[model samples]
Target: MHIKYTISVIFIVTLVIIEKENNIISKVSDKLSTQLTPILFGPSLSAPHNASADQHEDRLLENSTWSTQQSSSPASASGGQKHILLLATTRTGSSFVGEFFNQHGSNMFYLFEPLWHVERMLSVESGGTNASVAGPAYRDVLHQLFLCEFSLLESFIEPAPQDHVTASLFRRESSQSLCEDPVCTPFVRKGFERYHCRVRRCGPLNLTLAAQSCKQKEHHAIKSVRVRQLETLRPLAEDPRLDMKFIQLVRDPRAVLASRMVAFSSKYKIWKRWAVGEDLPVDEDEVRKLKGNCDNIRMSAEIGLKQPPWLRGRYMLVRYEDIARFPMHKATEMYSFIGIPFSATVEEWIQHNTQASKEVSGVYSTQKNSSEQVEKWRFNIPFKLVQLVQQVCGPTMTLFGYKFAENKDMLMNKSVSLIEERTFL
Candidate 1:
């Protein structure tokens, strides 16, 4: 009798929430159903480091029971802005996961990569792209960004120059939306050089107005590949004035390294250490990518675990494999963490976009057959490189609960040996 009553209460709460979201979703799409099936009504959930291994305690629930009353944000509770950060390195599927929120949260104002603007400024001053951002500097920028202030970015920010790999990071929609500045809105939409849409009609760009134009938003999110440590973000994470949450995306290091190798060559430090005019190697810089990838996540998680009590319930760490393998279930948990309701519109969007295909896609596109993405590294990469990443990133991987295959030696054939072969324990 008690279980029945509890289920009935949950069902009633879900209906009320659906009724609210439908009002918004209905206006946008004719295709989404007015009523979602009962499947979206699972109990609320939080990040699971490793359910089988019991690495971290379940912060929300094993099952979901959706209710708007349950979604908590210090910002919302105190009448301030709510900020969500997508924290991950490149090739970790942060883009795809970010798009999940971008598409689902209709009220959300998205900022794709505010840090890239900072990175650009740093690159100019230092004469290269291979430099790490100072934590304090990064945090100061983020604090203003969370509050919807875009003025600082105007100094070095411009429309993406061309259709390059990181172009999606500077997409105009996010740039325009995150700022409340009247100048920013028009500059990104028209005045920018690369996307010269209505150049003849626009006057001289008032960049100062652009700098100050970030509008405070109800739901503000920014996804970036620039932040290298959780500690760098410690200030905002601990700020009493701001309500912030994090979605930390993790992928198998083998897959990360493989993707990086495909994307960049050794002369390819995306400006991490490219001081002045120094000549960088023109080889596959797997070693540099591997170390940075492993160290950042390992160190970030370690620092996050040791964060102050106030930071609890601020982070949801999800593996790319988990989401790819179980899209509906994982995306539901992700949305739950972000305080967004999972409606049929969101479900339908995922279904429509993720249809499997043979065509290789870039990270920027929201349309991906994500399940296939999880295992592509297995076939695309050679065993020698796999063995190398596994060796170098082994301990870090273990901390994140990523297991190895049974046939470890198969990663290397007789023909291809690692630069330094270390025996696996």
Candidate 2:
């Protein structure tokens, strides 16, 4: 009996040692495979071997930890449904990024700037930002929309959605999801149905139909610039009915201001006035407003990056510069983060849109020679304003890897890269 007990103990110990060795070997093999494989998504052009920063940038793009682990399967809520919010401010290339999901497939229901109406309604009686009444109002509307409840939205729509139907839905045509099928006129040619709403020749959008479409979709995404703070969205993220994820998109403040100047010339008339070599008062109202905006952006980003309990595995930070430089690559990362397959249809759209034969210009047009668009502002914005922006938005810029320009010459030199390669998460 003693001999048998000794033999059994030896056998058990042997099995334990083998199991430990197997685990170590498996982990090492995975690490080696990951290192050896080329990044799944990266720029078409390779950087010089000697350029360490460029090499680091490529690696950063490859290793984004949007979810706990990268997998081929989609990470979704309990019911196989997902909700995504593309959080960005004006002129931050959100519309361009939003299109990635918009073109995703029949499974995605994308809403473009649905919160524009809420902002417009409250702009007249605004009491500054945080104190403004629009804060809770914006959140409430978004909460309802995520649930496919449109009655709250109808309250804000101009001309009112009578019995939950109206033609005045803000930017209705931009959303292909709203432009097709039961919501849009069915008689139009199949291929052209997406563009039918652009002409407004179709009948009004029935809120009932829109809600039905939203419910039928497997996933939903909304792109909005209205929500100012990340913490304010905690309620939506914690809601049991929704599986919410946020992609906070930011751009270099200098580029944003430069783009806005051209896009909203009338609103930025004061900026143009200061562009003629006049001295800028950093303490003035315009400058203070710019500073405040930067503060808000940086603070919100800080909160998201901290990965608070409600946001863990649900928050992603993306820079517009990275996307502009490598649209398809960044789009792949985003879709992966949201636990969705990056479709070839989105790939084709990026190819066509980013490499336009000629420069297509519009205040809101997504088409551009993407790489060229990143530095276009370096030539357009005066050095004085650039300096002012850096003074006010320095922390935000530094956090997102935007390097400061030492002088006007360095700012204009296309070879001296202003964006650094930094990894978040």
Candidate 3:
């Protein structure tokens, strides 16, 4: 009995000692974690190291939830006028997205494709084209536009806009601000719905009145696909007169190609032939052209996503897929990023356009059942072409959270979403 009692005491004492040691070790570990956390997860680090892998993952998910990272620069916080540039490539659903800001309110001045004239005039003058050669002109025009200077724009207008008055202002009806009374002859007609700009001829746009209207507005926004490189716009972004924000909109390259094939059929004749199962000469000039477009888009996105010093707080990367799926939500987040109120006018327009029951016709129509529009390209384009685009644009697709399908069956499977849930800031 004495030996058994002694054994019990030893066992109990051993367990107590072990528990105390464990408690001490746990306390020490927690203290180390607290002390090292700042160093591990400081501003110097883009992300926390492997020690906080779970935390890092959570942060990525949070960022991907359509939120903008706050800018480190003091200029971003400074208040006055706001300039928003909805930067995108052709056939990337930029027109529809631009409507978000366009419909903000009467207080917002929105311009649709002002760069249209620049590209047109320059393309004619050069007898061909070179975006690099025209980069300075593009920057100057954009800078002036932000400051409500319309005289520079008049120079680009064909027939030379007699004293800043011209009927040929390149889709003047597309802009609600330009279409409204005082800037044009008659006011917007009653029961005049959005996307019916074609039906309501607002007459000639007066550049003087338009500039006056722009100055009266609290904020200004412009949508353009012509600016080939984000890096080229550094000067405009850093311009002291304007507080600028750039939202870089991207779409799956496959979808862009499919949309462009139909929209610019003349230009994409080669692609249409490929869509019909013709042998895609991957080495041909057409193929190289497609590859070059993809490279330019990807390079611009990289510059924006990297958040260079000039573009730090000003740059935002958004996927058309995300916006299409959740138009109002994404628009709200976008407005928040730009520090604007998500007005009811914008919300009502989004609901009307995105949830349309009938198919809206027009190559450049912003109205559509956006959810269906997101996947419509899959049926329109062939698997072979999809493979080619993926090959050329694989890095871009991966960077923007697009997933690849292994086969045609997988490509047609709508149940399997190709958009991986990832964020680009």
Candidate 4:
């Protein structure tokens, strides 16, 4: 009887040890996977390492629901001026538009693709993109990150009482709590603290400490530019502290397709699947032909129309052609729409920094002068393809005041003759 009792005790002890080991192994595996996996958005692409691994980990911990602290300080909350966010497909001149605003001396800042951070974080948490399918948890995580980034910005500009108190009393306290997750905590804290130091002396107790806590000057603006994460932006629009304007940039679909073919082939490979005839690798030739197709332009227009109405008036559709023809006028109009005064300095900057003059059919190189390249699509594309594009995207083209060749055959014949004449000359 004694031997049987001893054997039962040993069995129970072994089971507990095995269970504990399994839990530890599971946690270690999760951390390793999160570290090793590549972050992806739309397709596989690398994200800028804006923060250190330790900062990222801390950000995650701080963002966890169980980790948050109740607000201990009171600060007045009020609405502020609306921030303008530019949204568009790649190669549609969104960057140029953003640069125009940046030169206009508005408090505006340009961010390349801010939503990538949230997407990467969610992917890590969910194990992969497949697991992050459209769901409540995915939506919630996205929303939280958006809100946290925005709130961090607000704390910098106008520190809440809690922020003020925290910065002053516990100067070493982690600012990662301000962000939804701890991943970006150190970066945020360092940035804000730097800003605070610039204006005032650093110490254990003051509003200046809060202001200097931000690491990046444009943290708020940068966080706002992630258009793919529109769902996150929606709730933020309601906050009185934030006034939001969305500028949806639309271009001829052919131009968009052509540009994407060159610029985003690796990032958006699915585009290659849409190609017809000869199974051509999405190369420069296909990009050029596609650029002149009206159907491609129409598809882009459809995308614009499908967006919410509140986003429409806030959006001003600019044609690549018009921008090329009247750069100053379009620039002026854009500034006015965004409620910023245009200046001679802005004009000079546009002339100096513009990429409208450079030519590359389907490829976008970061080294190319963008302002000079803006309207070069007209010279390289074939007339027949242009007509086909006009035929397909006629309604939208007409709506946007795009002029089409009166006779498709005549235009093609003229183009061919001109090419021959140039060759002979």
Give the per-residue lDDT digits (tens) of candidate 1, residues 1-425: 99999999999999986675554333212211111111122133323435543422232223221222323345544265557898888888887777766664435667677676767655554454443333444565676666554434443354522321112224444433423335433333432333222323222334434334434345677888777777677656655445688878878887776676667646434322322234556234646666767987888776666555545777777777777767888889877766657767668877877774656455556567887776676666655556667777887878776655435454433333222211111
**TM-score of each prediction:** 0.64, 0.78, 0.78, 0.46
Model 2 lDDT per residue over 191-221, tens place: 2222237744566677799999999999999
Tens digits of per-residue lDDT for model 4 on 1-425?
99999999999999986675555445434533443333211122233479677766655454332212211110122123335566555677665565555454423333334344333444454444332132222233233222222322222122333544433212122122122122123333232442232222343233233234322222222222234434434433333233444455556654555566567668535444443323434456544545434444444445444556423334455665556546777888866765556777679877765443345322432223544454445544445445656655667556555456566454434343211111000
Pairs of colliding residues, candidate 3? none
Residue by residue across 1-425, what tens digits does model 3's lDDT show?
99999999999999986675555445334533443333333354347345477877666455433123333332444346789999899999899999998888899999999988877866675454465556766776787788787766676677777667676777666788987767756644453223334545664567899999998898999999988888888756655556789998999999999998888889877778867878756557877877888888889988887877777788888999999999998999899888888999999999999876665646778888888888778888889889989988899898898898778998998898888987665
* Candidates by lDDT, descending order: 2, 3, 1, 4
Clashes of 3: 0
Name model 1 segments beyond 4 Å from true: 1-73, 76-80, 128-133, 158-169, 173-192, 195-216, 265-289, 406-425
RMSD of every prediction: 21.0, 21.7, 22.7, 16.5
Q: Which ten residues in a row have the lowest lDDT in candidate 2?
A: 66-75
